[model samples]
Target: MQETAYAKINLALHVRSRREDGYHELETLFAFVDRGDTLLAKRAEQDQLQVVGEFGGALDDPFGNIVMQALGSLPRPDGLAITLEKSLPVAAGLGGGSADAGALFRLVERAQGLPDDWRQRAAKLGADVPACVESVTCVGRGTGTDLEPIDSDLTGTPVLLVNPRVPLATGPVFKAWDDKDRGPMPEGTAREIAEAGRNDLRDPAISQCPVIAEVLAALGKSEAWKVEMSGSGATCFALFNDVEARDAAARAMPSDWWQMAGLLR
Candidate 1:
């Protein structure tokens, strides 16, 4: 079976407070884009994961991979060979890896009946895995594992994703987060993500990787409704009023950066 591991985009991320386990308490609106990696799994005698794509080499060890951790979570009666087509930029704050694990978990759940505590098991793979499993708009709280589904109607919303190709790790960015919070997102459905719904990681991420700012500025040059960095850094998205404008901006984007335009699902 094959599945598309959609990229996880943070429409708005707010780092609420630091937790006891050194992780930050966060509340962010999570959304998935059409652009992302693809996973193909098949039943085989020996189980193994073969990654093939631009950033596949970065994950040298498969054992320590989230995909492997997910398989370990549930007992597979039949060994399966999984191939990951790494299309999304790694560590670019698009949740490429987390989404991959989440996609695999879904595949496993269907192939082999997963446990009732599957959501928690998915969380064990990573904090973001649980939300990625659903691959929809959600409010991520606590360590980002505690999820509360939100009814967001972004049907015709045009979005353009641009990245400078710089991989910014989340750990350092969180450490660089300011003393003050970005305040919590007001309770309600966000048909259109408000400009006030800010991304707290922006400042620190920009401080570390200035190119991200440049991408944001590039997107700003266009007539977008709202433009901001997606997650930690690098990958910034511009929500245009329509798909035509968004696609035009994406096509005109500099070759130095990676860009993709699509209507939000």
Candidate 2:
């Protein structure tokens, strides 16, 4: 089976508090984008993984990759070969790795006829894995594991994702968060969540990578839409009401930056 593991951008993020486990409690509105990595899995005589693609060259340690981690958790079949065609930037807060892991789990479930409880297994890999499995907008809480499904009707909304090409480490961004206390859930429906606008990590992320501030400024300069940073840093996005506006904004973006304008799937 083959499937695309879509990347996600945080529409709104609020850090509530620091847990005793050293993980931060957070409330965020998550939405999957149409752009991301691709995975192809086929049953084999033994369990194995072969990764290849544009970003594939960067993965030296296959064991450390979430695809391997997730596949390892499943019952070993006679054999299996999986290939990851990576598109999302690594460690860019776009949940690229997490999505790949989720896709692997789904492939295993389908090929092995496993039970539906694999989503819990996906969560064990990362907080974003579960949502990536669903690949839709959701409200995530409690270290980003708990998920409440939101409407999936973002057909008309166009989002332009801009990665400054600077890799930002998530650990440092969370470490720099000033308030560890959790906050009340933002009011209103999913639409409100998307339009309300917030990213708890934006300030700390900018502190970690000053170029992110410049990315935001550039996004703001465009009259196409509302802009916000996703997850930790380095990757910012703008939401436009329509594709025409989004295309105009994409054209206005600097040539040096890595940019993708597409509808939220």
Candidate with best lDDT: 1
For residues 188-213, what per-residue lDDT tens digits would candidate 2 score against the true structure?
A: 77667767657878999999999999
Which residue ranges in model 2 land beyond 4 Å of their true spot?
A: 180-182
**Full-model lDDT for every candidate:** 0.84, 0.81
Tens digits of per-residue lDDT for model 1, 1-265: 9998888888888888887889888888888887688999999886799999987988888998788878878887888899998888888888888999889888987897778899888887778889898898888888889898777777557888898888899889989987686578766566444466889899999999998888988888998988889889779998877888898888778998887676676
Which pairs of residues collide in candidate 1?
A: none
Deviation in Å, model 1, residue 250 alpha carbon:
0.5
RMSD from true fold, candidate 1: 1.4
lDDT of 1: 0.84
